[model samples]
Target: MKNIKFLIAGILFGIILSKTQVVSWYRIYEMFKFQSFHMYGVIGSAVLIGIVIIQLFKKGIIKDYLGNQINVKDKKKGFIRTLVGGSIFGLGWALSGACPGPMYVLIGQGALSVIIVLFGAMIGAFIYGVLSKKLPN
Candidate 1:
């Protein structure tokens, strides 16, 4: 029953993403290019709502997922690490015109060319996993 609920939730999310056109590469590219605010607006609104919820729940005022309290801890990384990671991520997004989520959507939409991006993503993830222990925590 839990697995069925999870599957149904995933399907519902995919349907909503498709219906909202949020999975469109053109929409993502437009947001990246700053030619359209639609995608950013949606994301920003989500962030805002999340922030409000977290704040209200932080005092043990609300239950969390699985009825546990959120840790409310901030994980800090070095500035250099943040800059380097952001630059690499931005370059990939710019080049592909699709972020990870949209890349999967593109594949589902029958864009065979997206396989190259997916392959690269998989390789990148593998390399990251291999190097992760060597990198600072």
Candidate 2:
């Protein structure tokens, strides 16, 4: 019941991603190669929208879908951790031509090949979960 709405929304999002060719591996490759601006435009638009949404949430100008107040908190900055994590993420995306979000969308679009990437992601997450307590905050 309540979760059905999210399921529908996810389906809609997947459709949009497919129609826009945002889930295409070639587009992602082009983005990394600087041979096309199409994916950059898409990413920039998303970032702008995210900034606006975050600002609205922080200002109490908008609430979540369920009507709860949105609280934006600033976490302690970890520059080294951020740099290392981002580097690893970028390397993985470059190698796989897909990030986690688009990986699922690609799977939804019948890209069974992306299952390997998803499996690796799950393994990485499991390792992180197992070692998080021993890692830095």
Candidate 3:
């Protein structure tokens, strides 16, 4: 019952993404090629919103649904690790035209092709899980 709110929010978010063409492979491709500002604008706005939300959390201005204190951990700056991880993520996004969340939305919108991307993502996650202990922190 209480989870209905989350479902509604998810639906709204998917609708917005679909309407804004954020789920479109063409838009993603244009962004990657620097041929369009549409995707970059959307991503920039999201990053700004995220920064604001994180700052609010850090200042204790917002609480969880249960009203508990929310703690934002400071991430360690590791240039090499971040470079490697970001490169892998960017490569996957460039190839698939959608990240994980948007991949689900694309599937819901009847894009069956994204299922292959989702399957590959699942396999990658499984491999990461298997190799996590052997990999660096």
Candidate 4:
């Protein structure tokens, strides 16, 4: 029964994404093409929410859903690695017309064609997991 809540939440989230048109491929294309601000506005709002949540975690004012204290840790900084990763991620997003989050939502919204994107993402993740130890930290 505990997992039912998560299932409901996911359904609600998928509905919100559909109603907001965030799952639209054209919206993503417009964002990549710099032809519209709609997608940017949506992304900026999410960033703001994430910032607020991180700040709460940093201040010890928020806990996980399981009631454990949130711990924010500083990780090693690698500017070149970050730039490379961001470039690759952006390229993939532009090519696929869907980022990681919206990929499943697209499938849920009857975009069966995006199955290829999802499959590619899974394979990429598997490759990353296999290669992560050999890559820089």
Using lDDT as the measure, name the better of candidate 1 and candidate 2. 2
Q: Taking the tens digit of each residue's C-alpha lDDT, what string does model 1 give over 1-137? A: 75787778767866777777787778878888899989888889879998988887787778765798766876685988788778988898878877677676677778889999989988988998999789875
Candidate 3: residue 45 lDDT (0-100): 100
For 1-137, candidate 2 gives per-residue lDDT tens digits of: 97998999988988888888888999998999999999999989999999999999999989999899978998779999899889988998999988888889988778899999999999988988898889796
Best by lDDT: 3
- TM-scores of the candidates are 0.78, 0.91, 0.94, 0.93
lDDT minimum window of 10 residues, candidate 4: 67-76
> Model 1 Cα displacement at 23 (Å)?
2.1
Displacement of residue 42 (Cα, Å) in model 1 is 1.8
The digit string of per-residue lDDT tens for model 4 on 1-137 reads 97898899988988888899998889988898899999999999999999999999989899887889978987789998899889988999989889887888999878899999999989988998898889986
Stretches off by above 4 angstroms in model 3 are none
Summarize candidate 3's per-residue lDDT along 58-132 as a digit string, tens digits.
999998878987999999788887998889889999998998879989999899999999999999889988987
C-alpha positional error of residue 104 in candidate 3 after TM-score superposition, expressed in Å: 1.2
Worst 10 residues of 2 by lDDT: 101-110
Comparison by lDDT, 1 against 4, better one: 4
Q: What's the true lDDT of residue 75 in model 1?
A: 63
TM-score pick, better of 1 and 3: 3
Candidate 1 ranges beyond 4 A from true positions:
53-65, 70-72
Error of 3 at 77 (Å): 1.2
